[model samples]
Target: MFRAKPTFVLLLITFIFGLIPWIKAHNSSLSFCNRTCASKHGSGGLTLPYPFGFSDGCEIKLNCSATGKATVGEFPIQFVNGDGIRVNIQRKCNRSLKTVAQLFGPNYAPTANNAILLNNCTEAAFPCEIPSILVQTHFSSVSCSDSNSTISCYSERNKRAFIDLERLKKERKCEYLLSSISAESLNTSEAPVSLAVEVVELGWWLEGQCRCDVNANCRELVSPHGRKAYRCNCTEGFEGDGYKAGSGCRKAFSKCNPAGYISGKCGGTTRIVMLVGGIVVAASLTISLGLIMCCISRRCLKWKMRRLTKRHLSEATGNLNIPIYSFKDVEKATNGFSDKYRLGTGAYGTVYAGKLNCDEWLAIKRIRYRDADSIEQVVNEIKLISTVSHPNLVRLLGCSIDYGEQILVYEFMPNGTLCQHLHRERGDGLSWLIRLTVAAETAQAIAYLHSAIKPPIYHRDIKSSNILLDQNFRSKVADFGLSRLGMVETSHISTAPQGTPGYLDPQYHQNFHLSDKSDVYSFGVVLVEIITGLKAVDFSRPQNEVNLAALATDRIGKGCLDEIIDPLIEPHRDAWTLWSVHRVAELAFRCLAFHRDMRPSMTEVAAELDQTRRSRSWGNSEDNTCTPSSEVCSSSSSSNVSERPLNFHKAELAGRRELLTFGEKSHVNLAQHILRD
Candidate 1:
C-alpha cells in the first residue's frame, strides 16, 4: 500500500488541529449574520423582527402574554414595534427612563426623536430624564419646560451611544415608561391618545459589530419595505454561511474522486478520515476535560462561597458590633415576613416590625431584588449608619445577607412615618410647634452630614415619608438608600438624580450632578408638606396645583400663600404661631429655588430656623413688645395680610437674614451622634 508522504501528513495534521476550528467558527458567525433571529406571538399580536431578538442575542427579549401585554425580561410593556417598545403607563411607577434603557443593556440605544414620558413628573422641571447614551446633556431637548407636568425630550444624536449601565443607574433622573411608536406619531395633531408610551427607542445595532464578529463576512440587506437588515455571508474558499452551526466552511469538491488523494488532494477518503479522527480526538479530550472541570468547578464554587462569607463578615459586619443576623433569626423575628408584622412598603423594600429576644423592638427591611442597585443600597445604608449617630437619623442596628436575602434591621419607629401624621393616619396630627421642631431637627441632622463629617453626605431623598417618629413623636430622618457621599474637595458629585418624584431637585434632575444643595431642595419640599399637609406631587388637585412644590411656589409668588395651607394644619390666630408659620413658608420658598446656587446651604438653613425659634422665645419673654431687632410686626400691622405673605416675607427675610442669623451650633453637632439609638 502506498502511504501518504511525511510532508503531506504534517500538513493534514496541521489542518485538522488548527484550520477546522477556524472554519467552524467562521461558519457559526456567518450563520448568526445570515439568519434573522425574529419571532412573533400571533396570539398576543406581538411582532419581533430584526433588531428585536426573541432569544439571547437581543438586548431585551420581547415576551408577550395571551392578553397582548408584552414584557421585556420581567417588566410589563405595552407594545414592541420596528423602532422601539411602549411601556405600560400604570406599570411604570418608580421606574425611570434610565432604568428602562438599562433593561436593554448598553449596546442598545433610544433612537433620536424618541419620546420619553415620566411619572410623578408633574412637579419636576425639565428635561426630567436625560438619555445620557444619546447625549451627555440636554442642550437640544425639544419639549422640556420649567413647569410642564409631562415632558418629551427628543434625543440629541438621533441614536444612543454605549453607556455604562452601572454609572447610568447611579446618575439617571428620567422616569421611563414601556411603549414605542412610529416617528410620524411625533407630528400628530396631538400626543397619541389612550396609548401614550413611556418608552426609549433602542438603536438597531451595537457600536463595533452588527450582532456579529468584527471579522465575519457581512452585507447590509434591504428588506422589502426598504428597511436595512445586516446579514453575514461566506468568504472565498470557505463554504456554508460561515457559521459553525451551518456546518462551517469546507472544500467545494466534497464528492471528488479518491484518486485525487494520490496527488495529495485528499479527495473524499482523506477528507472523511480527517473529519473522523478530529471528532474522535475532540470527544476524548472533551470527556477528560469534563471530569476535571466538574471537580474544579465544585471546588472553586465552594472556595468562593467561603471566601465571600469571610469577606462580608469581616468587612460589612466588622468590629462595629452590628449583628449579622441569619435568615432563620430574621424569619423568626418577623414570623416569616408576614403581613401582620409588616409596617409598610416603599420604593426599594418592605418594612416589618420585629422584636428581639432581648425585647427591644426593631424594623426589618426585606428588599425586593438582589440586583446590584439594591445590594449597593444595602451596603451604602450599612456603611453610612455605622458612622456618626444623630437623634434625628434612624439607627441601623444590624443586617442579614443570607442566601441572597437582604435584610436590614433598624430601631422600630413606633409612632410611624411623618407622612402618617401629615395625611394618612391623621389622628390629632402634629402641632405647628412639633412640625417646626421636626423641621429644625431634620435640618440640623442634614447639616451635620453636610458640615460635620470630613466629606459630607447628601440624603438624596428628604421627604416626609422618610422621616419617622417614635412614641414620643420625635422626628428621625430614615432611609439612607438614596444617600450619596459629598466631596470636600469638589464642588459637586456627578451622579444619577434619585429621590421621590415630588421631592427630587429640579436642577439636579436636569443635570446629573449632586450637591448638599440638592438635600436642601428636598428638605424644602418636606417643609412645604409639613405646613400644607398635602402630598408633594398630587395629581387629584387641579392641573395647576397637581404639584405641591409648584403650587406652593406659585401661591407664594402671587402673594396668596394662606389659601393653599392645609386646613388640618391651620395655625392658631396668634402673632407667634402666625409669625413662625410665615417664616417657615419663606424658608421653604427659598429651598424650592430652581437653581442649586439659589438654595441656601443646609448649615445656613439650620442656623436661620434656630434663630426663628430663639426670636419667638425672646418675644414672648420680653413682654410681647416690638423691638428694633425682632421684626415680627412690620409696617403692615393688620392681623391678616391682604394677600399671601410668604413672597413679601421672603423679600424682607432675604435682606434681613444677617439679623436673623444664629451663631449657635446645631443639635446634631452637639450630640455624640449615634445613628442607631
Candidate 2:
C-alpha cells in the first residue's frame, strides 16, 4: 500500500516541471501566438483584421464608439477607410507647422506631398509664390518621411533630395511654416498636401518561427536559451501542422485517400495517454477560470451595494416635490459629465446631453463652480421657471443641488442654438422665410411673457444664443437666469443693466431703467441679425461697423439696407419680397429706437410681423421708398450719430419727418441699388 510505481512517479514529476515553463511562455506570448485573430474593430466601425488589431498581431490600436466615432491613441479619428485615415490636427501640433506622425497614431507617417502650409505673419519679407505668407512661402516643392522629423523643401516634384530645413529657418523672414491644411490631398497634385497615414499597412500579418496555416491555433513553448518556440495545431476536427509547417493543416476527412484509405488510428496505450493529458490541462484551466470569475463577482457585488446605499440615502434626505435625482444618477446619465456628452458651454453653465432614459435625452446644465450671482440666479431660475409653462418656452423637467453642484435639467433641443444657424455653422443657411418665421415665433414668445403673464416677465438676455430650436426646427426661448418679473404697477424696473453686449438696450444703459422695451430692443437687434446675417458684436470689422446694431442703423439711415443684407436672400427680388423686407426693416428700425417710450411693445411687434406675413406688402406705403437712412434723419434734424446718448425726443421727431420725406436724395441711389431689375 505504501509503494508508488517508479515509472508513474517519474512521469508525473517530469510532466509538472515541463508544464511550468510552457505555462509561463504561453502566458507571455498569447498576443504573439494569436497574431492573426481579430482583436477589435477600427475607428469608423470597420472590422479590424490581423495587421490592424490592438495587440502584438496588429500594427494599430483603434477604438470606435457606438455612434461611429473612432479614435487612435490620443487623437480623435475623423475617419479610417483601409490604409487611408483622417485625424484632426492633434492638440500639441495644432499650431505647429512642423508636426510629427506619432501625434496621430502609431504606424502613421506624414503624407507631405499633398499638404498646403499657411503662416500667420504680418508681412512677407521675401518674394514668395503665394505672396501673403499663406502657404507657398519658401516653395521649392516639399516632402517628408515617416522616421525623419525635419520637413524639408525639395527642388522638384518626384525628387528625393531635400533642401536643408535649418537653412530655410535662417533664410526666411516670416513666421515658421504654419500648420498643414486640408483633410485630404492628391499625391499627383503640383503642390504638396500635408496628410498623415500609416507608413506600412500590412506589416503584422507574418508570423515568426511557426508557419501557421489559415485558421490554425498556435501556442508558445519556453526553451532553455530564454527563447520562445511556437507550435501550431489544426483546430479540432482537423489534421496536420500540430507542431511545424512540414505538413500544412487539412480537414480530417480530406487526409484520407479513397484508393488506399486508412483512418489514422492510435493504439490503446497511446489513446489513454492523450486522454489523460487533455483532461489534466482542461481541469487546470477550468479551475483557474472559476477563481477569476469569483474575484470579478465580489467586485461587482461591492459596487452594487455602494450604488444601492447611495440610492437609499438620496431618497431619505431629498425632500423635493419636483423630481430630484441623486448625484450618482446625474453622473451615470451624463457619463460623469464627460466632454463627449457636452452640448455647449456659456457664462452661466455647461449644458451636457444626458440620457435620463434610453429613449429620450435631457439637456443637463451643470454649474460646477458657481459664484454668488450664479447661485442666486439658479435659485431664481428654479422658482420662476417652475411656475411657467409655454410651448415656446423650454420646460424645466428637474434639478439637482447635490455635492455643491447646481444642475438644471431641461427638455433636450435636438437642433442647436439659433446662433449656430445664423452663423451658418449648420451646413446650410436658413431661408428668408425661415428667418422671418423665426423672428415672428420668437416675437410671439416674448409677447406672451410680457402681455399674457399676470406679472410680465422681462427676458433681459434675448440673444440668438438663448433661442434653442427643436427637432422640427421650431424655436423656443431658454436660459431664464437673467429674467426679471415685472410689476404691473411700475413703468420700469430700477436695476443695473444686464444683457448681452451687442443686444443690450442703449436707453437702459443710459438711464439704468429696465423696461419691457429693453427686451424689445434686444429683439430688434436679433431682427437686424436675421436681416443682415452678421454678428451683433464682431471686432473683425472696420471701426464704424464694429457693432452690428450701430452698423445696421448706419446702413439703414444711408438708404443702403440692400448692401448689408445676406447674399443668401438676394435672389428673392419680387415686389412682395421687397415690400415685406422693407416693412420688416421699418419695424426693426422702430424697435431699435433710442427711447423706451418710442420703441414698439413686443405685442405690437408680434402683431405687425404676423400682419406683414399675411400682406406680403405687394404695394403699400410708398414712403418706405425713401433712402431709408436713419443717418439722413440725424443730419436733416440737426442730430448727430457722434452725439453720445442721443436726444430720443428730438431723434424720434426727426425719424418721423425722415420717413415722411423718404428717399428724396438717396432714394434714387437706393432704388438703383435695391430695386434693380
Candidate 3:
C-alpha cells in the first residue's frame, strides 16, 4: 500500500463515514418501497389490492371491519378484477338519484363499460338500449308510472371510462336510477342471473401526478370530468404497484445484470466515476427542487389572496344590519344543493333542508329564476316579509343574495305541508278534529295578513300546498312570492291574475283585480279539500267535476253533501261531528261564491272557524244548545237576506237534520255510495 498524507487521509475518512449513513438510508427507502401490500380478503371473499386499502395512505380508502369485511360507504364490494371493481347495488323502488351520484370519488367512478338505466325521465326522447317492458320485468323493484317516461340507457365505448353523473342528470333530465350493469355482460337475448342485485363496474385510478418508481412507467389519461389523470405500471421484468409511495417495482428474475456490482464486472476506477456522476445529478436535483418550491409558494399565496378578496367582496355586497349569510356557507349547508336535502320544488324555486354552521336547522329556498324581474321579486319578498312577524307565518331567518344567487332561509318545519298530509301518502290520516284545527289556524294566518298589517298584504296564492305545518301540526303560511301590499284607499289592486289554476278566484281571473278576497276564494278550495279529501284540480275525475270547488258547489247546493264528503271522516259521525261538518261546509260554500263581494272577509272567516272549533261537543249525544258565535249565527240566519241566494233549500235544511239523527248509519251508506261511484 502507498503511504498517504495525514491531513488528506483524515478528510477522506470523514467523507467515508458520512457516505455510509447516506447509502444505508437510500437502500432502506428502496427496500421499504419494494415491500408488497399484505393481501387481505374483504366482504364477499373479495381480495383488496394496492390502491384499495383500509389505511389513510391508500389511494382509495375503504371501510374495513375487524372481521376483514370491506365497504365503500354503504355499498359492499362484490369483487375486484384488474383496474375495475364490481359493487352489488341493492334494488330499491324509491332510491334517490343522489345516492348514485355519491358513489363517485377522486380515484374511482362508475365506468363507461356500464349500461345505466334511468327511470322517470321528464322527456321521452332519450335513446333506449333495452325495451321498457324488459326493464319493467327484470328490474321489477323500480316504479315508473309515467307513460311518457322513455326508460333510457346510457353507455359509451371510450377511453374516458367513468360516468359523469351531473352531466347525465342535466342532459337527460332523469332523476331516478333503476339499475346498472357491465356492458360486456348485457345481452338482449337472455336475462341476467340476478335481478335483485345489480353489479356496477367502477374503474379506479391513482389520483394526481404519477409517483412511479425508477423502473416503472406512467400513463396519462383524462377523467370523466375532463381532468388530467394517470396510472402506473411496472416495466418489463418487474412487478408490483409501481408507485414509490406504495409497493414499488421489484425484479421478477433472481439473476443480476452484468452492469451490477453483484456480477463482479466493475473496477475501482468505475466506482469513482459513478460516485462523481451521482454527486452532480444530486446537486442538479436539489437546485431544481428549490426553484419549484419557490414558484409553488408564490402561486399558493396568490390563490389564498384571490379567495379572500372574493369572499370580502361578497360580504360587502350583502344586506347590512340583517342576518345576511354567505353563498358559500349556504351552499355547504345544503351539500351543494344535493337532491337528498330537497324538500320540494315549486314554480319559482326549490326548497332544501340545511343544517348551518351554528348548529341550526333551516329551510332554504333557492330562487330558480335569474332574470331582472325575478331579482326584483326576491327583493320585494325580503322587504315585505321582514316588516311583519306572526307565530303562524313562516319566519325569514336570513338571506343570501350573492354570487348571482337569491336564496332565503326560513325556520324549518318538520311535518312538511298541509297538501302532503291531505293528498299524498304521508303518515296516519288527519283526524276530523285536526283538520278543523288546521283550517282554523290557516284562516287566522290569512286574517293576520289581510287585517293586522298596515297597507294589508293580499296573498294572491293561498293553495293548500303553500300552507306549511310545524312539528306540532300548527299551520304556517308560506310562499309570499305572489303576495302584494294592498292600497288602503282602493278596494283592490289591479294586476294580472297569478295563482294556481283550481284555486284562482274566477272574478279575479276575469277582471285582473287582486284583493284579499282572492285569498279567501283560494282558502275555500282548501277547506273543500279538507272536508272531501279531493285535489283542487284532478282531470281524471268526471269532466264536469274536474274543479274541486265546482264539484263541492254542485254537491252542497243540491243537498247531497253525503256524496262528496271524505270517507275517512265517516267513522267520526257523532251528533256534534255531523253538525260541525255541515257548518264548515256551509261556510266554504259562501266563500266560493262567484262574486268576490259575496265571500266573507278573512277576519269573519277566522272568527267563525275559531268559534266552531271551540263549540265542539265530544259526546255522542245531541247538544242542540251548542252553537257558533253570535256573529256567525247571525250571518247564517240572515243569509236569505243577501242578494245572492245561499243555495241551501228546504231539502238541504232537512238533510242537516237527517245527518244529525242517522249519524253513523248515514255515513256508512255514503261510504258505500262513494265506493260504488
Candidate 4:
C-alpha cells in the first residue's frame, strides 16, 4: 500500500467512523424488512397492511375474526391506507368515556379529522354541533335521556391530530362518549346523516425516531401524554410505506418514460417540449373546470335547499288553511323592516307592525337567526295555533318561508302585551278588572291547550309578555314557539327547561320533566306580575325580592298579601275588591307550589278565576260604593256567597282555612272572612 499524506489519513479515519453507524443501521433495517408478518384481508375487503398485521413481528397487532373483520381493540377497522387507518366505533346510549380511553395505543390515536361528542356531560364548554333531537333519536335509552345533561362536541383546527384524553377528562366532566364525526363529513349545514357508527381516522406511527427512506418525509408526533414518535410519508412522485424497514418509497409509474428522454428516443426534444406544454395546459384547464364546477354545485345546492324548504312549508300548512306570502311582499309590508315599523324584539325574533296588501294590519315576526331551530319553531307555532280554535289564542294569518327567511304573520293586537302595560307603560294602565279579565282569559287559553286536544299541547312558555291585548283589552296568548305536543299515555314529557328565568318551573328545571303543571307554574309568575305590577325578574329590586314570584310567595305565605299588592288597585279596595284580590292571590300561591302535583290544573285555575270575576260582578251590581268596614258590604255579600256552593276542592278548602288563620290578626282578616263565607 502507498503511504498517504497526513491530511488524507485523518479524513479517511473520520469517514470510516461515520460509515460504521450507517452500515449497522442499514443491516438492522434489512433484517426488519426481511422478517415475515403475513398480511390478511378484513371485512369489506379491506387490506391489513404491514406494521398492522394479525401475527407476530408486526408493530401493531390486529385482531382478525373468523368472519374477516379486523379490529385493534373495540373499534372495527373500516379501511387501511398508506398514511393511516379508518376505524368505526359504534355509538351506544351508555358507552362510557373510560371505554373510549382504551382506544389510544403506542402505535395509533385518533387524528384531528375527527370531532368527538361527549354525552351527558356536566360541563360542556365545547361547541355542540349535533342537534339534541338527533342525539335523542340515536341514544334513546333512559340513561341518555337526562334533559338537564349537556352534550359537547370537541374539535380543533390547525392543531395536533391526536386527542388529549386526560385534558378532556379534567376539563369536561363528560359521562359518556356519544359519537365521533369525521371532519370531512361535516358541512356548513352542521347536520350529519347518521350517528349510529362514528368513523374515526387513527394516524399510525412507529414508536421511535424517524427512519425514513431517501424519497420520504418524516413527521414527528407527540402523543396526548407527551411521548414522542414519528410517522413517514412518501414524497411527491413516490409510493409505498416510506419507512426503510417497510416497503419504503418507490417512484410512481407515469406515461412519460425517463429512459426514453435520456436516450433522445421517442421523438426527442420536440416531443418532450410538447408533452411538457400539454401537461401544463391540461392542468390549467382542469383547475379552471374544477372552479366552475364548484360554483355550479354551490348554486345548485342552494336552489335545492330553497325548493325543499318550499315543499316542506306547503306540506306543513296544506290543511291549516293559512296563506303563504312571498318574501318580497313581506319585506315591502314592513317597509323593509324599518326601525319605525319594528314593534318589539323578543328572545327568538323581532316583531314588526306590517300593513299587508289587503289593507290588513298584522304583526310580522321575523326570526332573528335563519337556522333549522328557528324554522322548526315557526312550523311548531303554525301547527299548534292552527289546530286550535280559541278566541283567547293568537291567530296565525300567514307565513313566508322564501329566500331563506322564516317570517310569521299574525293578527295584530293594537293594545300590545300585558307586560308592556304593567311594567313599561307602553299603553294606558290596566284597571284591576281588566287585569283580572286578562288573567282569566289567559287561563282559559292555556286550559284549552292542556285539556281540549286529544294529545294535549303544553304552552311551555307562559308569561305576561306572551299575553297580547286587543283593542277591547281582551287577552290572547301568543308566542307558542316553545310549545310541545304532549302524549296521552305519558304523565309528563321529558325535555329541557325552556322559558323566561323567573317563570321557569323550578321542578321542571331540576327534573327535566315537563307537564301541563309546568305551564301552570309559569302562569303563576304572570299572576304575580298582574297582582304586583312588577317585572317578573327585576334586578332593581332587593336581592331577595329579585324574583317577583318568590317575593309574592313569601308575602302571601306570611299572610302579608297587602304588602305585595299593586298600589294602583289599592284605591278601589272595597269589601269585594279585597276579597277577590286575596282569592286570586291564594290561587296564584297554589299555582306556584314547588311540587308539580300540588299545583292546580289549568282547567281548575280557569274555573276559579272565572268564579272570582263573577263574584266581583255580583258584588258590583249590588253596591259599588260599599266600603270594607261597612255592615252592608260585609253582611250582605257573606250571606249571598254562603247561599251558593262553590266547586272548591278539599285542598282549596284547607288552603282557605289556613289563609283565614294567617290573616286573623291583620286587615287581611276581613277579606279572608268574606272568602271563607
- Model 2 / residue 524 / CA error / Å: 0.6
lDDT of 1 by residue, 466-577 (tens): 9998888888888988776786325654544467767877777566678888899999999899889898866346655656888888887676777877776665555566
Q: Is candidate 2 or candidate 4 better by TM-score?
A: 4
Every model's Cα RMSD, please? 17.1, 18.3, 21.2, 14.2
Against the reference, the lDDT scores of all candidates come to: 0.62, 0.60, 0.70, 0.73
lDDT of 1: 0.62
Q: Which candidate tops lDDT?
A: 4
1 against 2, candidate with superior lDDT: 1
Alpha-carbon runs more than 4 Å astray in model 3: 1-321, 488-495, 617-677
Candidate 1 vs candidate 3: the lDDT winner is 3
Model 3 residue 492 lDDT score: 53
**Model 4 score (lDDT):** 0.73
Error of 4 at 4 (Å): 5.5
- Cα-based TM-score, every candidate: 0.57, 0.46, 0.48, 0.54
> Which model, 2 or 3, shows the larger lDDT?
3
Write down the RMSD of candidate 4 (Cα, Å).
14.2
* Per-residue lDDT of model 3, residues 1-677, tens digit only: 25558778989999999999999997765443211223254234334556666655556766655555566666777766446778877655445677776568777788765667766677653543333333443454344566555456665523445667766777666767766656543333333322222668887776667778898999886776677777778899998878787678888964434355334444434575665577688878878898999999977875665466446534543533347677788999999999999999988899999987677789999999757878777766776677778888898888876667889999999899898888855767788888999999999999998999988998888988898888899999998887788984256545435677678787774566778888999999999999898998764576567679889988888767778888887623553465577678878987898877777899988987876676554232232222322122211223332222224753444333212111233212211111000
> How do the residues 211-235 of candidate 4 rate in per-residue lDDT, one tens digit apiece?
9889999998776556787878899
In candidate 4, the residue pairs with backbone N, CA or C atoms under 3 Å apart (3 or more residues apart, or in different chains) clash, namely none
Model 2, range 1-677, lDDT digits (tens) per residue?
33568778989999999999999888777645222222145333444433344455343555544454455533455644433456554212124434332333334433323333423333444422111221222221233322223322211133212122343344442333433333232333332223232221111112246567765786654322234444465788777644343355667784334222223343434356566676688888888998999999977875675556446434533433456665678899999889999999897789999887556999999985757787778767776677677788898888776656778889999989889998998748887777787888899999999999878888889999998989878889999998878883266645445667679887675566777898999998999998888988764566456578888776666556778888887624544465456557767887888777878899988887875564433223443232222233222323332311111233454445222122324323223222111
